[model samples]
Target: MPTLTAYPLFRERSLLYLADMGNSKLKTSDSATAPLQLAREVLMIEAREVQALAERLDENFVNAVELILQCRGRVVVTGIGKSGHIGHKIAATLASTGTPAFFMHPAEASHGDLGMITQGDVVIALSNSGEADELLAILPPLKRIGAPIISISGNRASTLSRAATVFLDAHVSQEACPLGLAPTASTTAALALGDALAVTLLEQRGFSKEDFALAHPGGSLGRRLLVHVEDVMRQGDAIPVIEASRSLKDGLLEMSRKGLGMTAVLDEHGRAAGIFTDGDLRRAFESGIDIHATLMRDVMHRQPQTITPEQLAVDAVALMEQYSISSLLVVDQQDNLVGALNMHDLLMAKVV
Candidate 1:
């Protein structure tokens, strides 16, 4: 029998045959490095394409922003295939950042979805080749509807670009796909361009955090931005509070009953005078103080950390973390104790 390595053609064929088998242990240096090398190249290609796009940006990009800004209606983004996927994300980002926008499938536009477009609306169409048949077929109707088209395409000379009110060149030198057929780098460029437009519109509209929170009301971001201290603070009798003249025993009972891990000591005027917590109780115990005889005013911490009910719950978390305390007292404009909240309250509210 001849050794496999004795014949180069037989050895190459054997390796190729082994590669076809699903779990073959045969390995080659080139095969091992190819994936990593190709991945890096893809990233580099996409990055270069985006950088080129930035350089090629002219007055047209500015005009596109102005057009969207002036429109009284929503921004209708339409595309096909991968471009449609990117358009969906672009529309979402725009809507969340202050621009009222939605993705409209180009094929569906011909099936009566065209009515979604109006004279006041601005249309953003994405097509790398600028010749997506479905996209081009609806150009005339979009024109007749009086909606200005902003075309993002790789080929500026394509029909879509020629018919557009403003053309944005999203051309890339080459695709990240080794075969040059997949829409890798081009899709990345289009996505980046869409992001640039959405963010620019957001800045031009002076979109604030509150506006963003409104759009994302179901997420943690909404909780952090929209939830105020009053929303999570335990109010009315739920507040663990005792008069300063009350005994430590009374304060402990209030803390236990409210389950806030602490109790607010109120002054004669019913203001938040101090705070007493488990730590204070332990120290008081170590000091050999009489829990029944000692007043809250004598054992409580005076002028403890306080927060306004109108403030955000996230801010309350910050104050707690800063002071290394587990609870906070909510006060009103006149320093009247209104409510109380501990870490558990915030955690239960999912504000933390």
Candidate 2:
């Protein structure tokens, strides 16, 4: 035969043909079509099942929420394997959303973490087959404590389901996994159900953004939502203020010195009478008025928009947005100036 190097082009063409045939075979085969098609069909089916579970959510979900809401202690979630992982997430979501909850590994419970459960607490157990022996090991004691049990599982007839005060069916008709061994569709359904329960309880309790702030104190939402205008506003000497009879020159000097671009004019009783800004100074100058000779009382904008120091900094931001202004004067009930807040202040505070 001719040397293989002498036939390199033919060899390369043959290899490309083989690769194309292999890909074509894959495209036309049951092996390639079956898994993806089955997963899509199963996902649709499971999605419907999940929706039905949500719609037909009987007194059970309601009772479970009520049980958690009325719980004087924590909600302990327990499971094994993949379900255990999801249970951990559910516990975290519940805890962060006003329900006091934490994950307790079933195996750990067997080794005395069972003491974490007590009377007036609630137990949320998750298992796909609902027959995990590890989960069952501590059930009798958990039941003895009179803690109401909420079960999330596939089989309603499983021992875990039977022991529950409320059972949420997380059954998927088929696994999204091709081998049907991996927890795919079932885990998705369970996670969604857990979220539904957490959010439902969150809404029913009339939980506010401020309440969320308490749970997430380290985050920006917590700081912005929880901080009051007084907490972030400039107070006392930091405030830009001038008396009613002060010269516009004096107000401009105060504005420049305080770096707030504005100064509040206080009346005879020390109440905020008016405000003068750099913009006002420009308009006054354009009118041929003498800045050094004119009284701030005569040229300043009167009865300036004011907010209470008790208002939320977020609310102060809204006020700034609504009025199209960059600064606001915070005052007490008697209209006496207490603080000053500018757009830069809110930005620096990250309240915006």
Report the C-alpha lDDT of model 1 over 280-333, residue by residue, as the tens digit. Answer: 989999999998999999999998899999999999999999999989989999
Supply candidate 1's per-residue lDDT for 259.
Answer: 84
lDDT of each: 0.91, 0.85
For 253-326, candidate 2 gives per-residue lDDT tens digits of 99999999999999989999999887888899899998788998999899788899999998988988998888
Model 1 clashing-pair count: 0
Q: Which candidate is the best by lDDT?
A: 1
Residue 278's lDDT within candidate 1 is 89
Residue 259 shift from truth in candidate 2, angstroms: 1.6
